[model samples]
Target: MQALKEAQKTVVSNAPSAIFPANLDVEYVISFRYANGGQPAQTGDSSTPEEQLEKLLHTLDLAGLRTVVRDGGDGTLLIFTRIRSEKKLLGEIYRSRVRDWLHGIRPAAPEKETQQSIEKEPLTDGERLRLVYSLITLPNSEGGAGITPKQGEWNLVQSIFALHDHDFNKKWLKDWSTKWLIGPEDLKVIRDRFGEKIAFYFAFIQWYFIALTVPAAIGLFAYLFLPAYSSFFAICNCLWSVLFVEYWKRQEIDLAVQWGVRHCSTVQRKRAEFQFDAEATDPVTGEKIRYFPAYRRLMRQLIQVPFALVAATCLAAIIAGVFSIEIFLVEVYNGPLKMILKFLPTVLLSVFIPIVSTILTNFATRLTEFENYENQDSYEAALTQKIFILNFITGYFPLFLTAFVYVPFGEILVPYLDVLNVTVQHFGHDEKYTTSDTGFQINPSRLKAQMIYFVVTAQVVGFVLETILPQVKRTVFKKAKEFDSRRKGIDTQTVLDPPEEKKFLERVRHESELEVYDVTVDLREMCMQVSIFKRWEV
Candidate 1:
């Protein structure tokens, strides 16, 4: 039994990427080693992951049990290590084996024994084309279907557990669609990574911009004639932006039609994405409910209200502190410190805003757990809503206050010779206080200041918050995991524990997972830019 395990371990540990899939429903042979230590040969699994790798080792008999996967068993393991190459090998095995079976199943003529029979087989171009086309068009009768090979057959063959991956998506991706978006390709990854909501967002955006001309026009007009303060243009732009957003919402449904996603009957009748509550996988479909309706997602959304408030509080507090200091130094202070004080508000606000904002965002992240979204949509909707709130408050709120307040309040409150009480010495002559409404003009530099704040200061802030911070955090977390997993790697006591030669494997599973949220972020960032004409005007 021990020797069998040792051999099983060896066979699995070094299984080619062409053997079986991660979601093994059918098992195919992998490699055969003559118990006498002869050269090994590889085969494929036409069955599932269990039937194939779990088949008791070097001795074909049931000499021992080897776990095909580890932890949750949704994936495959070689020996005790969770290597993912088995799926690719399995896919190749499935294809080659199935193709051979198909060839055998096709009725063929016995070897032509006589000249008379060989002469009767004269083939014309038209007949050859018709026969060849018919043969190519036929399906595998055993499974009632054949694998649809696409351009990336080599890549697909490496994913032996393709069916499992597909099945996983087939079950979960359906329910996940409504609250989020999805596409034919992403259906599987969405089920695994962020769930349905995030996936649905992708599907929706892809579906949304099938006609992109309309929004482009509105943006162009806003660039051309719409002065920054034009009430008509402001109303039009705001209304238009909102209308486009709303229209896209409806368009998603219409699109859900042309692209095939509107009604979620599949998700509705299905299981939630994560069901820690369920005892075992279901019998009929062998899958638990992996999703739910938007109402539950909305329930999760309630958590965002406080998050927004907290973000607003943090943002306002930081900006107000800076504003107060700037106003006191510029307007009230008469010390020679005027020049030095000019930079104070910006410097202090820069530090305070990020610190406060970071704390609030952490608090907001904790709150997202309460969102209880079945798929990525409800989850991401709540997530992005918080993100948008942060963007708006940190980006727009300070400018709004500064634009209206600094001049208006300063003009009213600052000491000025009142026109009604002009000095007798100057009564006959025109008199004006340099501090009066007319002289206390809007700083021509204020617009430039605002723009600089965003372009330089705020941009640095954005990079820290979004890109640098997250990357640093990930690197730290990944290093910590590597250290811990190291000890686990050394602790195995079974025969499979012994060292064996390893072949080259190119990538890690799930490393290149696709995302729709990333796309949305890019588009929104582009929109946030000062339009081209606005920049040129500057």
Candidate 2:
């Protein structure tokens, strides 16, 4: 506790000046735990925590980022960072825009007077944050600080994340909540704040929501006015789907052009983890570049075939076993504790699927790393594909079984569940439980119930878990922290910041602890929703 107080005093003494300039705005934070008692030092590297911190600061300085260190509380340190030279950052942004123009990513070329043009348009918050992230995380060879958090030399570096603008976030959320449908300006705001990757996700979701309206109305009409299994409805559904896909392609292109990020995938930086087998010079730029043989990568990628097979087989077997047990309990069994036992399959499924999925996801990640794509985009794309496969199996396989196998050929399968009943009877010395005497009848409504659960119930539960629960947890944790601080007589009011700068510094510290938002997770969820909708329609 005494050491912590001293550390707080040291932080206050070293805090940057009161008048923080716009150029010095804290865009990113690098956090790491202190290597104190009971915390083992990085293996084979015996540097003390202060020495490691100094080295990291030196690296950031060399990378042209201004950094200020603060005590992050609870044995952690936070390094707040921004571009040191506004002029240099502007030049980098200008060069990036020019490259985009040259590659046909941007519709218009940047003006020849670079600085003047940059001043005219200025860098959006998203553009600045993206470039700063690249500066910090890209390899040294790519002109970045070469600090890969939680990897290699920076093993103690826990995270690197950007600070969120609370004011902007409040306004943005309120605006979105108030609007029934987001317009072009809303999308432009998203692009300026969160970059094109995240903006594209919202754009796709909005497009999908609007397109769904037509089919929804048609389905309603069919339900009210048409005969069961109407051919006209089916034909119209198919046609609408075809037209939606075709038009979305054009919409995607237009959004890309408007955002000035079309064809931006071509300009990806080399992955720091990429291993090169050879070196080559670019034909146009004559710059030395790393090369990995296509055939070698192809051989490594072949391993994915066996991996996918194993993953599918394992997950399918589990789901099938659970599904069978559930069927026997619900529809066939007439044993002791029958009502309570019916929930056992759900419990087993809830426990096992996540454990298995996590194991498979980790394996997929390792496999992706083994494949060693040259760029970040390619690496992420490969991993996303593998994960999507896993998601598809876990998400849809049970539904498929219920719809096709259970409903169509359930009579044959239910009698076979007698084997499970016999096994249970043998173990527990219960009465003979067999489907032959139970007068079992398959519930056709089961499939519809499961569909509704996935389409509506699961989505609502997921939203509450993803959005509401996190906020609640954060609030509780924060209040507890404050209470603990008060109990300890830490006096954060005085030790952490001067009166003039307290609010800003405290905001930075709070933002430092917040989780880094990954747009990929949201994108994956959207993809899963689309896949589920298509399967349900079929």
Candidate 3:
């Protein structure tokens, strides 16, 4: 905002003849630009923050950046372009919109003499129970799970939502609640069902298995040192890793069933983002989820292959370039401080690795952003995978080169650089392939590269990732902000009566301050958190 304000003077004096500027701060401008960079094909797919943001931006108003509308000669007219007229006014504005949305409040119709009529009907016990059930599901589903199952499927549904005493979280409004690993009644139920011995043992084993690795590490070494090549040590490590994986997998299923979350995935995958059609409440959940997956979600998924490919290629290139430079410096360059210079190659590679990794990461991030998946978990997971790829490349590639290329093949391959001359005796001049004078050597020095890359480079990477990068980003952002465009506008148009308009305006405000789109994006996010299935087997 400060920069935008400051830049306005420049816009007028330096570039005002061609510019007009109005509104919002720098980060919002950058966010707006990237968010609204281009129109998605009416659909977007990605499982990353950036992509979700892009989709949301497009779904709403993408062009809300304040602009200096250059409308005339030396215009410099600070004509504000409303990228999103309602977005900026958050807090009360957002709440008001959601309230209106909930109430089915909209632009008022022609005012007529208002009349109220009340009808009295006696309520039966069955009706009362139904109403009670509906109330329980309020703020979400109501009587969806109340009825006895006419079909076998409802039995499973009954079991899923079977009333178990949840360890109440003050945060939970209804069913979408965060829960502990095990609840008290849940423990009792598991004991009754699975038997106390089996259940207790299973629970205890899970607790200790996840906990004892440190002691286990010490124990492993104690046994290993007693008799190195220790089959016992090997067995323990292998057994622990395998057991952890297998146990966790089964435990997840058990927990899912016990917690009644196993059936959570049956909900639709799409957001029903803009509900132009679905006004009716869901028959199953009884919540007013919008339904706009008019197009198949799978069709939106073809973009993943391309995204993966782009990420892989970019990572590969960075790795290749970094490895080449490291190899050349460590093996070929016999420059000053040769002993210390050996470290120079590593130092240089270490420095370049992050830069290269960052570039690939940025590319992958952009690609993911382009893909726009709805669920934050899926979106973040996809982005995390991309980061992992870049990490693998820069960190692992140098080691790969050392092991396969430099250590194993350097002796023979380096000899090819030897001087070879072809003398043109009759013609007088001769052409020669002059190899460098240094003898090709493969020594423990090759391993040094690996050690440096793994130990030193890993620490460096961790520090930068955990600490430095965030600080740097903050500092840079603080120093500079983008001008031109902001989140909203106010039309005082009184589209709704003052009361209704307040509610409507609230809906359009900043999301932080706005109403939550009560419409869940469905079970897509939850499914993503669970295991990714290759295929479903009946």
Comparison by TM-score, 1 against 2, better one: 2
Error of 2 at 278 (Å): 3.6
Residues 371-481, model 3: lDDT tens digits? 544443455567677665555455455556666676677787654433221222233332222213455567755565455445446556666765687667755653342
lDDT of each: 0.42, 0.77, 0.38
List of clashing residue pairs for candidate 2? none
Ranking by lDDT: 2, 1, 3
Report the number of the highest-lDDT candidate.
2
> Cα-based RMSD of the predictions, in order?
17.3, 6.1, 19.1
What's the CA error at residue 279 for candidate 1, in Å? 13
Question: What are the per-residue Cα lDDT tens digits for candidate 2 across 198-304?
Answer: 88889999889999999899989998999766888878878887888789899999998887777888898887777889888999999999989999999999999
Give the 10-residue window scoring lowest on summed lDDT in candidate 3. Answer: 529-538
lDDT of 1 at 428: 39
